[model samples]
Target: MTSSIVFDPLLPWPLLAVLAVIAALGVLLALWRGLPGWLLRALAAVVLVGALAQPSFQTEDRAPLSDIVLMLVDQSASQTLADRATDTEDAAQALAARIVARPNTELRRVDIGDGEDNTGTLAMAALNAALAEEPRARVAGIFMVSDGRVHDMLQAPDLPAPLHLLHTGRQGDWDRRLIVKSAPAFAILGEPVTLILRVEDDGAAPGDTLSEMRISIDGDTPQSFDVPIGEDIEIPVTLPHGGLNVIQFTLPEAAGELTDRNNTALVQINGVRDRLRVLLVSGEPHAGGRTWRNLLKSDSSVDLVHFTILRPPEKQDGVPVTELSLIAFPTRELFLEKIEDFDLIIFDRYKRRGILPAIYLDNVRNYVEQGGAVLIAAGPDFASADSIYRSPLSAILPAEPTARVIEEAFRPKVTDLGHRHPVTADLLGQETWGRWMRQIEVDPLEGEVVMTGVDDKPLLILDRVGEGRVAMMASDHAWLWSRGFEGGGPQLELLRRLAHWMMKEPELEEEALWAEPTGQTMRIIRRTLGDSVGQVTVTRPDGTEDQVQLEEVAPGRFEAVYEGPEIGLYRLAEGDQSAVVGLGPASPKEFEETIATGDALQPLIDSKRGGVVALQDGLPSIREVRDGRPAAGRGWLGITPRDAFETLDVTKTPLLPAWLVLLLASAMIVGAWLREGRS
Candidate 1:
């Protein structure tokens, strides 16, 4: 109910000014002529001008809207730590009740959660979003209940009213965290790779030191060593094998520390082969020999040593014994002296000859037993007496020659077991690859037959002996398949899988189980010939076991997915088989440091001129103070109220009406003249 005066004009200001000047001049003329009626004439003219302007009263109807108080609550991972969650819940409920109790005031609660990855809290972003939803005029103030760790401080909105913070942490809260400053993805086996690690103390008292750090590989006994505070230290770690290696680093817990969860860290490094040394022995010089050489030499990682036997001992093409063109083969140095230097030995159509004595063959067998790979490509001579199976190498060979060879054109087909084996599975679709001609027949002994030729005879046999593997391709005509004689086969993929399988690649194992983490879920895969696996027993971080049944999705591939409830290392086992895989980072954002403290949110509090108030200090009462006044007190924080008002009634008075002013002015001048003449 406010009131104010308003004005209303009937004519333009210029016309009104001209009329005033003319009237003033007329009055002056009458006065100078000694007319007594001049004064009365002036009074009449003013009255007429006032009656011409039309005016009216104006009023506005307004009902006051409720004042808005925004309450931003930090519900992120950091807020869930220790007693902070309970503190925040209590503070939020109390603040909401107080704001609602005030006359004509409303409370808007905004919950802030964890950001993607380890990006920290997004407090300011939440604040900006809440501000946009409220009416600017009715907004009284903003209040935030959070730990001091806000990541988006620069994004805080330009608040129309004062902003207050009710922090939810204690002053003496502290934490110790293990930080992996640097780590590489790949490392050479048996070589020491330096990883930079640091143990940091946050919100700790000055002069407190971290005494010891323990490092371990795959849950083994930890090696304890001294580590200085606040400095990066290099720890040299040697990978023991060629595969995935998990390393765990931990720091000793100090007195008055916030939480021990963040005191440890886990890292995974993929181990690579030191070197792929290959020894290719060719029995005779042929076009297929060049194909094997070209394939092995093309790879930069492969160390290839090619040795070809161009002439046998029984050859009589030499002119003389001393003047022969062929040189004596050094079978002793190659097969016996340096055989251990090679990781794999490939024989392309090689046969037993007097060149390589029985003693050398025995050394080759020992080489295969001591973690070495061997691949034999048998030819027509495999059915003859000169076959390598007749030599000392027969002990390591997976197949024996039947002395009856089938020389015919046929397309090789993968067996049912091979379809599930990583080597031949998905070779070229099931029925879609080019065909091969000229497959030499052989009989496989106690090995798995992956491929069969004409008459359903084994063409490719694979077996394991000792710690090593042996693969026998009973056909030297595989090059014809590469040349697309009949059509063409998956010659390249077949050859690659064969070579890698012989090298004992983990992925190609027939009976294998592995799991990989994908966010909160894990993909558990098992490759086996069994129709179905028994219930897979899963051991969680909390030492709870859950049996999950696996379903056969493909011919031999079995899989069962499990979603981990928390982040940590998960162990999966079925019968005698077992595997270990990490689900997430050692210290997840939620459990990084469970204790609530103001260290993380300090920057935000300092920038906004706000301070932390622990719930243990008693839940403070909320109040609305005037703008620019102090917003916090001994037991509570205050939200400032804005001074705002609105206009209600307005009345405008008319200056003059045009017609009345004209008639009165005409009469005034005539009457003035009459009075003067009478005088």
Candidate 2:
């Protein structure tokens, strides 16, 4: 309770000043004229004026509020290194106990961990949130226990009080980090691609010598080499296959280092072929021959080898064989010598014309079984006895001709299976494709029928033999669609997808298992031609396996999303198909710099007249200081007292009552009159 005199004047202050002036004039007249009663009259006037000015005593009951001290504890990934976690916990508990024991003080404990969206340690954000929840006037000081590796120092809020840091980590803490300075997302297969990297030491490094680094491809045995410390080195890597290549680079752990998480780096580079080589064998010259040539030649990435048999050996013309314009077909070179060089082999209206010997046909069959691709476009000859399906290559063909040729116009339609097969799934303009005039009838002995012709007959069949793939197209009048026979279809795109699928492009595989990583989450997808697929077994970098069920979103397509608990390599396998992918980064931002220092936040601390002390030394003693003064010193941290209070009740009592002042003035007036009369 506190009391003070307060005025409640009956008249305006200007009016009271005029009354006071009259009283002073009276006193001056009495002094000048030697009148003894003048002093008494002046005293009465002063008492009258005082009665008009009311004075009251005001009392208030207030409760003092405790000063708030914000203590932010860093529990981020970096703080987990070495003994920093233990030190941070110990410092936080000790500080909390000290603040609680201090009179008129409150501790606002805030535990801050890893930040969202891969932003390292957002200690400032956590601190701001805690401050917003408390009364700003009562905030005394701000304290943090961390390694000083905050990534969001620029977002630090304006301090209402002193800010200090109780730093974690040790003096001689060192760390060796592998930094991939530059890496390409794509590289041509069979060619060397360069990856620029750097190896450097931080803190109190042991030596300035070369370090031995090991590199491996697709989990192969790692090869070790020496790399100069603190220098960027260029590593040239050649991909073995035309697909995604996983390369791992690691540096052997040095003694007295912070962690080994930053020692290994995983790089995923897509390998692509330089060009696609295609072998197109046309049994005879036809209108569709140019169409095949046009499609293959239009793509700059394709190298086409075309052969057209203008005449057979049985056909004798007036001109001799040497005089004819047709050149000898290179059957030996193309079919036997360099068969593996071709990525795809297309047979357009090919028949048993005796031009290719039986042994050559057998070699073509062997080619398909040895990881080759073949596409057969059949015509009327396919239904005849001389059909190529009747040759030695028939064993590898997907279908057998029934010796019946359908000669009616019918639109090609995708079967139910086609909607699921990657080769024909979601084909452009598939529902509005033009009609073909002729389609050779055939029976599918093995493989998937993707498209149907007239009477629901198989128009397209796709199959796999040994390590190769085969696709059979039963119509020769597909060229009509190219000429806009009924509104041109997506022929170009359809043929392009077919060629790529046949060539075993990883993206076009019917049965594929792959993962798409976005941040720390990976969406695992499995595509198959079958109606159903089994659960995918995921093996994390720690060699722990988990079976995740996939929900079918479309026909024969199953998918599931997984949030990775840690950063590193993850392997996904479904049946015999498997894929390896990397989530997040090889070296996370938290582990980039593990040594604890307050250099990042020193400026902010200094601006608020605060200081930083290492927990390794000892817990600092808490003290109180004035605002704008140094709030921290050797072995001590200080807080400022706000001296704030909340008023509960107030009372006002009149210091001098009006009646008593009036009575006193009247008595003095009467006494002055009697004195004047006597004088």
Candidate 3:
């Protein structure tokens, strides 16, 4: 309980001030006039004013509130290095015991770990959250047990009391980490790209040292080379394939190092072809010949080599050969000499001609079987005896043509498999395709049918032979859609995808598995030609396996989202196709500086008149001090006593009762009047 003098005035303060001033003036006049009983009148006026003031003795039923000391404990990934975790736990327990032993003091323990993402230690954020919960007046001080490697210092809250840090690690600790200073996201295939990297040592670095740096691509055998420490080295790397390339750079571990987590770094880059070399051979001139030429020529990335047979060798024209404006086809050079150099080979409405002998056709078939791509666009001539199928190339062709050619207006339709195949899947406006006037009747012998013509006959077929791929289009009137003969469709899109698929682009693969990472979450995707897919088994960097089921989002596509527990490389496999993806970084931010120091948090502690002590020395004793006094010493941390109380009830007793004041005032007046009348 507590007691104090408080006032409950009977009237407004302004009015009371005016009345007091008037009474003072009246007393002065009475004194000047030598008035009898003037003392009594002054006393009566004092008693009346005191009663109106209504001063009272107020008593409160009080309850003392315990002071709160916020303790922020860091348990982030970095704290796990060496004996930091054990040291922190020991110090925290000792501090808790001391605080609990103090009278009217409570400990608010806030355990801080890794951040929401891969961000390093967030000790300041945890401190702010803990402070927000408790009353500011009751917060005595803040105590932190950490390595002092805080990432968010700008969010530090204004201190209500002294802030002290108990540093966790020893002074002689050291670590070495690899840093990729600069790298490109994409590089042209078969071309050397430069990468800048550095090997850095933090805390107690050796004076002079040479380290062996090992490099690898896609889990290949590592190649090692000696590099000087504490300097940037430029490395020239050439990608092996045309897709996502994973390159890893690592340095050998050093003696007495804190950790090897930051020794290796991985960089992912996409490999793209500088130019697409396409060999286009047309057997004869047709209305759609210019369409193919125009499409290939429009793309700046394509290098088109077009040849048209305007005159057959057997045709007897009236004009001499010298006058004819036609050059001899380069079949020998293209089919044998530089066949593998071309990315794709296209035969537009081609037929068996004397220009290309049987030996040249056999070489073309061999080219397609040895990791080369071929696309055949057939016309009515495919059904005749002059068809290229009569040559040795028929062995690899996806379809065999019948002797009949259908010349009717029929709209092209996508087959059920086409809806799932990446090359034809989700083609714009596929349901409403323009009509084609001519198509060669064919039976698929070795590939999947993606598009059909009249009476559900195969119009487009795709297949993989040996190590190469092949695509065949049976209709010649596909250009009619580009001419807007009826409502135009995605003719250009369909042809572009078909060409890319033939080039074995990874995105157009029939069966593929890959993952995309956003922060710590990964979206695993599976593309297949089959209706149903099995569960994907994931292998983490630590060699742990997890089986995840996939949900069908489209006809041939399945996907699942997974949040990784740690940061590192992850391998995914479904059936025969497998992919590897890296999440976060090869080295997380927390491990960048494993050796702990108080340099990061010293300024924050100094701002609040606090000190930092290492737990290696010993845990400090807790002490109570005034708010503005020094709160930290060589071996002690301090907390300010709030002396806070909560009031349960209040009782008021007026100093001067109304009845007593009235009786005293009346007697004083009567005496003043009687004395003045006698004088």
Best by lDDT, which number? 2
| Candidate 1 per-residue C-alpha lDDT over 1-679 given as tens digits, one digit per residue, 9 for 90 to 100 | 4334344556776777677778788778878977799887787766554544344344444445678888888888777666788888988998888889998788898888887755567887887778777667778877778775677667866666666667776777777777888999889877999999877777644565655888877656789998888889998999876666778887777778766667777788888877788999898987678778877787777899888887676775756768866666777788888898888899888887788889888888888889889999887777788988898888989988887767676778899888888899878754655555556667677679989888888989999888788999987777775676556677767887888788876777888887877765888888886666787888886789888888888878888889988666677888677777777765566555445556655554444344567777777777767766666678867665654444444444333446656677777777777887798
| Residues 1-679 of candidate 3: C-alpha lDDT, one tens digit per residue | 9899998889898998888888888988999999987898898898888888999999999999999998889999888988998999999999989998998999999999998666788888888888889999999999999998999898988899899999898878888888899999999998999999988888887754778899988767899999878899999999998788888888878888888888888899999989999999988888788888888888898999999887786788688868877777777888889888998999999988777889988888898889898888999888889998899989999999997899898988888999999988998776577789998999899999999989999999999988898889998888897898778778788888998888887888889998988776799999998988999999887899999999999999999998887666778889998887777775688987777777888788887788889898898888888988888998899889998888899999988888888899999989999999999
Q: Each model's C-alpha lDDT? A: 0.76, 0.89, 0.88
Best candidate, TM-score: 1
Q: Predictions ranked by TM-score, top down? A: 1, 3, 2
Cα deviation in Å at residue 668, candidate 1?
16
Show where candidate 1 strays beyond 4 Å: 1-59, 116-120, 152-155, 205-212, 221-223, 252-255, 315-330, 590-611, 616-636, 643-679
Q: Which stretches of candidate 2 lie over 4 Å from their true place?
A: 1-65, 279-300, 303-341, 350-369, 384-395, 427-434, 479-490, 531-535, 550-553, 644-679
Identify the superior model by lDDT, candidate 2 or candidate 3.
2
Ranking of all candidate structures by their lDDT, best first: 2, 3, 1
Instruction: Pull out the clashing pairs in model 3.
Output: none
